[model samples]
Target: MKVNYTGFQASEVSPYLEVHQALKAADHRNGKPDVLAYTSVARMNPYQALLYRSFPDHGFAVAPLLKPFELRDLMLHKSRASSITLHLHWVNWVLAGEPDAQRAQTKVSGILGRIDRFKQLGGKLVWTAHNVYPHDAAHLEAELALQQGIADRSDVIHTMAASTTAALAEYTNVDAQKVLVAPHPHYRGAYEDVTSRAEARAVLGIDDDETVFLVFGALKEYKGLLRTLEAFDQLLDQDPSGRYRLLVAGGADDHPDVQEFISRGLLHDRVLMEPSKIPGSKAQYFLRAADAGLVTYTRSLNSGAALLYQSFGLPVLATDTPVLRETLPPHTALFLDANAAVDEYAAQLKALRALARSTTQTDVLDGIAHLDPSAVSSTFAQDLRSRLGLRQH
Candidate 1:
């Protein structure tokens, strides 16, 4: 049941299913690829799975997880396919996590050099601007250079939000001409939404009276858990009826505030914090049990969590970030000012509770019907193919 969020190969999964996937991948390996990916996607996230599902007929496989210097090795084995396209998702990999500015700059330069070599070898590159900048930035200068370099060399710069162009432009120059706006697809078919609130509540032992505000995803500091916990504590203090509850289920980072929140037993009754990655099968339980999804992100460029909540028909109580402005569907969200105080977020939480009570769940679910994966998958797949200069079948 315990996975390191990255390394855990829990027995909760079916070996037969994995082998089936592997067999399919093997088939793609033997055939010439129409579109091959080079991404550092973690084992936990379903974004990659949902994405590649767009190409059922075409031979699309994750080619490799090569490091910056190691990409040159791919030159030895060239695909004979007319289009040799590679999508490098999360370009921050080379520039992120290095604290030393000089080292970070060096890392960026080395990757840039590799990218130049890849271009020389006739490999078309498409860069997805997933984040404006890392929330926990250690070297801003290096990251800026990396972003600029990627934008310059990318045949297509795919962005999920139009606001991302402006947000990223604040730090690095973004070419509007090359930018393609492909909205983050919802998790409609990714997780089952068949579980009713009553069934889910009983499974989690949640009372029907409790106004559950669910916080799902990795328990990172930039996720604004401190402010969220503070705001939740404030709400509980004001309401003696004990009708409110906050359920935080995700893998925890080593943030001191979050660690304290995880350690404390005082608020266990009102605040249920599951400090681990929730498995895919169990995702429905959290989604169906909650009245509304809660997110108090301090800063972010993209929020898949918002889309996940929307996919499941749960309205979100979220910080009003530019990304969320473009991402959230109508009548499905209660926004708190991104620059607001903890007390203001608490007020929004209360407002969200009110909103959830007034609106029918069917109405909320209907709001996100347009976001079904089938709706966007074909468009996104086509845009990507066009950018890569691959002719549509």
Candidate 2:
């Protein structure tokens, strides 16, 4: 089938490069020559050097067919392809709030009209539910309407966590039968030339004895950054010996809540903050320097960060949510109640810190064994073929 993959940012933040590598490797082993192309905002540049290097011989190319607010024309052009796998991009914009309600309605109308036209051309629509809803959705009602529309039209819906199936149905009213539970692939061996934990810590100026709790990735309001800081502060006060340090590393959002936290002088020598985009080459420093990774998401259905932490052999301390509980086993991660008091969270952090110190490398490896990328890719390829009705060679 001629498949066009959309919503993939060919940047360091996205997991598309890893996913593409795994899928391509699977295809090579299976001797399948499926034509796969990705839609990007622009042509290849230095920013996509890592992705290009990884998949040099893989039959993947960047096709600049889609642009923002041009869904109708793009879909009409891409209708020649057998299918379009919508990842996580266009829907967010379509559902985003505009100051003029009429203008927003017009845009939605145009998108829906194009979707119908694409269907008329016998093109299949697939959506991967990366989140139950957009993390930064401004117009909830409009976004829901668009979600429901997409769910109604989609031939297949993919979700990383099985627990999110019910939430997906609840939010988008998608038919449960159409949903497929595919675990998010592990990012093993994705980053190149990773530095050792000791060396990374030395570069970051972190002490050998201090237990580091890292809150990595883009810093957003819903990531529970303030709550994490509060819990870490309490832990420091309770310990009094300065045994733990909180490292908040990631690009900061323009939201007032995050700005307010920064303006209050909350960041200091102990509470280290690296408010910048972490490149792929330097990502391992943050991941390796830490004793444990902190995923303090106030609200989320799935966490790529938790998987990343496990991939890097760091025990995870994540917020207690059904999706997280289902995705990460008790042995892999220790869960904290999102609604718990600061003291309670601090106590949990302390316990996790102790656990991290006691946990062995073998135990960490065993915990993350299920996230093997080869196995994940094989399953993903088989599922895709089955869903698309492609005959096995």
Candidate 3:
């Protein structure tokens, strides 16, 4: 079965890359989905010199989604072109408040009308719920309307987690039977170990023995950077000589909380922030250099970062939120109740740092082996085939 994925942006850092990579790998493996096409909403508009670049090969006919009329014509005649299997990566524009919401909704409604026609033409619709509902109140009504529109048009809906699926079902027009929870496909790059404890420290310009706690990703409000800083400060008071350094590797310029952390003397050189995106390969270096990975998301669904840490065997110290509890074992790394005392949180981090050195590194690496690319890609392919009414073999 051939498949076409429609998303806001297919090549950017979001989970759409996971969809592209998984589909590409599946095509290589089973040689089914005979064809895969990727259309990006951003690509439809002319923009240039964006700081980020797209992955050159996603094994799909990548294109810009043209105007509403063009989209209708394309979908209406997709059989002469390729099979239409719409995957809704995001519905932000269709849900309003974004730039040109009126125009975007007009275009999207035309496409939805075309999708209804596609079903009559024997096309399949698989809408992936990257977000169940927009969190902001301003977007609530528009989001619900878009949800109902997709529900009315789609043959099935796929969500990354059961929790997300359940949340999505609260919206009208979503048939509970049509939603399936598929875990986000795991991602693995070639395993590159830190050169050495000393060498890893040298690369990051830190002392070999300094205790490091790593925080990865663009600093977002609910990600709990402030809480993480507070915890780190508490840890420092216990042992000022502990030399606990927080190597913050990700874009942080947009977050005022980060600057607040710096200006308030909560962090000095101990808190390092990367103003740009880091290459995938060098990710492990930061992971390995740190004593443990830190995730203080006061609010989150699930973190690919936490999974990445788990895969590398780097123990995670995260708030005991629904998503965190699902992925991590209690005390294997450290899990603190969101309301836990700062001292309690500090103690957990302190213990992990001490125990981390003596813990078998191979154990951590071995655990992550389950998250290897081949396993995730295979699972993704089987699911895609099943959704497309094609036999995997």
State every prediction's TM-score relative to the real structure.
Answer: 0.87, 0.82, 0.72
lDDT of 3: 0.57
Residue-level lDDT of model 2, residues 1-393, one tens digit each, is 874343334344233343334344433443433423323332222222222232213322223234434333334324233333333223676655576666666766777777777567654565667677778877666676777777788777777777777767568787877776767655667665458989988998888999999888888988877777777778888887957888777778899878765554254557767787887788788888888898877777788788777778788888888888887767757988878788888988988887788886567767767756556545655665567564443
Report lDDT (CA) for all predictions. 0.73, 0.65, 0.57
| Top-scoring candidate (TM-score) | 1
Counted clashes in each candidate structure: 0, 0, 0
Q: Could you give candidate 3's per-residue lDDT for residues 187-295 as a string of tens digits?
A: 3344455466567677778787787888876666656667777887888889898878888876555457766754553336567656456665677667767777877
**Native-referenced Cα lDDT, model 2:** 0.65
Candidate 2 Cα deviation (angstroms), residue 69: 5.1
Q: Lowest-lDDT window of 10 residues in candidate 3?
A: 44-53
Q: What are the runs in model 1 whose C-alpha is more than 4 Å off? A: 1-33, 56-69, 77-79, 95-99, 192-194, 265-267
lDDT of 1 by residue, 221-337 (tens): 778777788888888888768599888788887889778777762356888767898998888998889989977687777888988887777788877877887778657788887
Q: After superposition, how far is residue 224 of candidate 2 from its true place, in Å?
A: 1.1
Better candidate number, 1 or 3, judged by lDDT: 1
Q: Is candidate 1 or candidate 3 better by TM-score?
A: 1
